[model samples]
Every structure is written in C-alpha cells, then in structure tokens.
Target: MVFILDTVMCIVTTMPQTKVPLSKRERTARRLTLCLMTEEKQRRPRPSVPYGPTAKTVAEGVQKMRKRRQLTIYELSALLKKAGRPITPSAIAKIERGERRVDVDDLMALTTALGVSPAALLLPLKDSPHQSIEITGAGEVPADVAWEWASNERSLPLSSGDASEAELGYQLHSLPPGRRYLRSRPVGRAVEALRRDVDRVVEISQRSQSRHPSEFADRLAAARLSLGRLEAELARMEAEREEFDRSSREELERLRQEAARLVEEQSRGGGDDGAGVD
Candidate 1:
C-alpha cells in the first residue's frame, strides 16, 4: 500500500499542469497593452508621393500667405465654401503639405479664398524673390521673372533678340488695344512736350531777330539744336509705330485667310453631306 501511494504521488508530480483562468485585473491589463500596440502601428508614417517644383512653390506660397494673414485651415476652407467652390480643411492641409496636387479649379478656389492672385500662388515672388524656380521644359528661372511673365507684366526671356513676328501677333491679338498702348502714353506725352518747346523757341527766335540780331543768332542756334533733337526722337517713334502697324496688318490678313479657308472646307463638307442624303 505504501509503494502504491508513493507511485501515485510521483505520477501526480510529473503530470503536466493545466492553465489557470486570468483574474479581471490581469485580463484588463493585457487588453490595454494590445490596444496600445495597435495605436502605435496606426500612427506610423506612410509613403507619400513626391511633388514637383511648381507644386512645392504653390504649397509653400499658400502656407506662407495663410500664416501672414493669420488664417486657420478651417477658416480658409470655410471661405472657399462661401466662394462657391468648396474645399475641405483636410484637403487644404494636404495641399499645404504638398501631399495633394492643386488643379486649375483648386488653384482658383484657393486664390479666391486667400484673397490673392493666381500668380501669387503659382510663384514664390513675394516670399523669395531671388530664389530660382524650375519650369517644366523651360529649365530654371528667377522667381520674380516667372511671376512677371505669369502676370503678363512682361514677356519671357526666351529670345535674345527682339520679339518674333509670331509673338508680336499674339500680343496684338490677345491684349486690348488700350492696354497695348498704355505704356506708350508717357512717351507720347514727352514727345508732345518736346515739340511744344521747339515751337516756342522758334517763335521767340523769330521775334527777337527783328529787335536784336546778335541775340537772335544765339537763340536761333539753340533753337536749331533743340529742333534737331526733337526731330530725331520723332523719327524713332515714327519708325516704331510703322513697324507695329505693319505687323498688325500682316497678322490680320493671315487670320482672314485662315477664316476663308475654314469656311470653304465647311462648304465642301456640307455639299458632300447633301449628296449623300439624296
């Protein structure tokens, strides 16, 4: 009996132990640990698409302007919604981070919301005037230069020589007549003033010639010199005007011919359609 009892005790000692049920506190602690692990995984950064130089410029510009205006992302989004083009705060955040591309519609909406011009967002002209910006197919150019070109303040520096005939035609066609001649107004006024001065000097010289020949000779010489300068300036202005007129006429003629050709083609097409119907 003693041997059997000892054998039973040895078997019980060697037997595998069963798992114990966890207490409430221990189970709760385990659940919390798993939740924390999942939260950490969720917070990990994901890969983002790289943005282009232009997109980066726009993003930076938007962020800079927003900060300058002391506007929150939510406020800007609200403003955009009020402007009839709604963009959410999340989308605005993505745009400012360059994680999202700003399309034409988005650009217009952002410009309106931010109270800035499209050019302001497109270029870093205000934030970093001296910085170089890369234009696709155009290579790198100064920010201010790009802004000026974008704003139509000046043409691009693509050509070393004077603007080509095609460029002149484009400008003449695209811009209003008043805007085209706006810059020349000052030149015109200067020319008129010079002409008046020349006329006054000539009149004075002529009147003084009868009274005092010596005085008249000196005055006449000065008047002649002034007249020569005025004549030269007028000649230059006349040449420029003639060139502009010639270019304008040529462009208009070309457009007329193009329109006539298009009309003839349409007429032929119509005739063919009529024959088919018959």
Candidate 2:
C-alpha cells in the first residue's frame, strides 16, 4: 500500500499542470491599463509658440496681395530687385508657401513691391467672414488714433475725407498729416494750364510793344498782379501745411513718449524688485 501510494504521488508530481485561461476581470484590467498609458502620452504639453507674425498669416497676406495685383512671383522678385533689395522667385515662393519667415527689411521691401502698407501684411485681414466691419483706412491711422478708434469708434469717428486720402495715397514727410499727397494728375493739369497762359501773355506783351504803350503797361500790370496773387496763395498754403504737419508731429511724439512710459511701467511691475543690483 505504501509503494502504490508513492507511485501515484510520483505520477501526479511528474504530470504537467493544465494551463488556466485568464478571467474576464483580469483581461479587462489589462486593457484599461494600456488605455491609461495611451491617455498619459496624449496629455503631454506641446512646444512653445512661434515668434513674430505667424507663417500662415504672412503667407496668406503675401499670396493675396500678389494675386490682387496680378503679379507673378518672378515679377515681384524683379520689383524688389529694382527697389535695391533683390529677392528670387524661389524665395517668394517659399514665403507664399509658409516655409519661410519674413524679416523687417524684407517685409518693407515686399510692401513697397506690392504697393500695400506694412499693416496690410502685419494686421489680420478685417474682411474675413462674420467679421467684416470695415477697417477702411484703419491700417494707416496713427497709433494713438488707432487705439482710440478701436476702443470706441463712435466717440471718435474717423473723418471720411481723411480715411479716403489714407486709402488712396501714402503720407509724405513734406506735407500735412492727412493732406500729404496732392494727386499728380491735378497738379500736372494746373502746371500745363499755367504754361499756356504764360505763353499767351508773352506773345501779347511782345505785340503790345509795336501796338499801344498804354495797353502794354496795363497788360503787364495785370499779369504781375495775377502772378503775385498766385505766389501769395502758394505761400499761404505752404505755411498752413507746415504748421499742420508740425502739430501732427508733436502729437505723434507725445503719444510715443506716453507709450514708452507705459511700457516701462509694465515691465517694472513684471520684473524682480532689483534690490540686489545697482
């Protein structure tokens, strides 16, 4: 009986144990663990924001301006070349494709080439869907005026004439703020008319020498008076324009100084107490 028992024990010990299947709860727990690991991976933080204007904004602005002007990339490159800052068509293509960032100098050149303001490139498009309140000449308004207008346009509305001028022409250093540029066509017409009048007077004055001394004197006096009046008008317009420009510049300077002071104050507030430094 002892031998038989030992034989049975040996057989049981030597036999391989049957493999057990995992329980439903165990399998579910393993699946949940894998899902939690995946969720943790998904919760990791993204990279830092890009500096300067976003690539997409710049690219869209460039392409939009180019198309609006009906220009090829090569043509735009040529225009920049003429402006003393040469850029290749491939470079323009890279910019339009959002593969490159534009430098300040390049941006100025691009605006000049495209005949648009720097704001046209730097500012978000105002005419986008569901956000189409007209910015009109908002891009060209002085920085302080822009801030005011943005905050409350009804309280400080932009003059329509000033806005129209801003949209049509750029400001000139030599002229008043809003009335800086006189349309060339009108000026040219005036000049041509003046030339014709001068020529006619010269012809009549020469003929008067042989005809009537009194008539000649009268004609000459009238011409001199007219010329003097024209000169006086021009001088008065010039003085007024200069005065206007001077005031505008002073205002702009004041705004700039105020902005600088505000920025300094903000910086100081955000920085360390500077107790350790000189």
Q: Pick the lDDT winner.
A: 1
Instruction: Give the TM-score of each candidate.
Output: 0.47, 0.31
lDDT, candidate 2, at 4: 48
Clashes of 2: 0
- The Cα local distance difference test for each model comes to 0.72, 0.63
**Range of the 10 consecutive residues with the lowest summed lDDT in candidate 1:** 9-18
lDDT of 2 by residue, 1-278 (tens): 85446544544444223365667666555555555554556677765445343455667889999999999999999999999999899999988887677888999999999998776776455521123232343424443333323332212244565664553443333335433334233443244335434544575565556766665566567666666655666777788899999999999999999999999998886675564463
Candidate 2 deviant stretches above 4 angstroms: 1-55, 127-278
Clashing pairs in 2: none
